[model samples]
Target: MATRTQILIPIGIAAIIIGAAGLISIPKDAKLEQTKFPMGIVKIDGVTLQVQIADTRPLQTRGLMFQEKMPYDQGMLFVFDGEAIRSMWMLNMQFALDVIWFDANGNVVYIQKDAQPCKSAIETATCTFTNGNNAKYVLEVTSGFVDMYDITENSKLEIISI
Candidate 1:
């Protein structure tokens, strides 16, 4: 029979090995900086939202993809050079969203609520696209946000910062 000391020694070594393996298996992106994107504050009616600014093409292209979920008070804002027709897709998204399009003067041009994610390859290939006309900015938030906040086409966006 193994002595208690010998048994405990092996068990502790095994535990350490398992812990190291688990840490190693964690994705590198999991440790990415929380402040990777520039932050801004926006308001609709009287409600406020803290948003990640996606002003660059690369940032806009990667908007909200691969993320697990967004906080209720947080969103992503896409900024464009000028007001025009804008389009968005939901490929590789992990959750549904509510998208709002705002024109240059902060007027809500259009709204797309509860846009579903496309997780699989087939879904990605056939993903639905949401578009709005004369939109200079696009804001994406968690699903049901429009109804919760009573956001409408007439709602105006107060861009506190960008």
Candidate 2:
């Protein structure tokens, strides 16, 4: 029989390896939720939300695709270089969301609410949704946000950042 010291040593090493591997598979939602990103306060109608900025290309591409849950009071804001028709797709998203577009002055230009997750039927080419409107910014919040908060095309936004 192997000595107790030999068995215990192997068990501890195995645990360490397993823990490291588990970190690699941690869901993006959990990691991103904990990350420190530039945050801004957004108000539409009487509702308010704190949002993360996705101004970089990599972050814009990620765009809440892998996240499973977004807090009601928190969201992600996408900033573009100019006002143009920008389309969006629900490729790897795992939860429903509401996408609201804004003009340069932060006025609501268009809205897409309750956009379903396409991770299950991800191979289908029908997952894209767009209003084909010109917008300089996009805000993605939890599902039902538009209806729940009564955010309409004429609603205004007051974004303040520190």
Model 1 agreement with the true structure over 54-87: per-residue lDDT tens digits: 8977677667877889988999999999988988
Q: State how far residue 108 of model 2 sits from its true place (Å).
A: 1.4
- Model 1 residue 77 lDDT score: 96
Give Cα-based local distance difference scores for all models. 0.81, 0.75
Name every residue pair that clashes in candidate 1.
none
True-structure RMSD, every candidate: 13.6, 12.7
* Cα-based TM-score, every candidate: 0.75, 0.72
Question: Looking at model 1, how many pairs of residues clash?
Answer: 0
> lDDT tens string, model 2, 23-64?
454445434634445677877776778888877665665677
User: Model 2 off-target regions past 4 Å?
Assistant: 1-36, 120-124
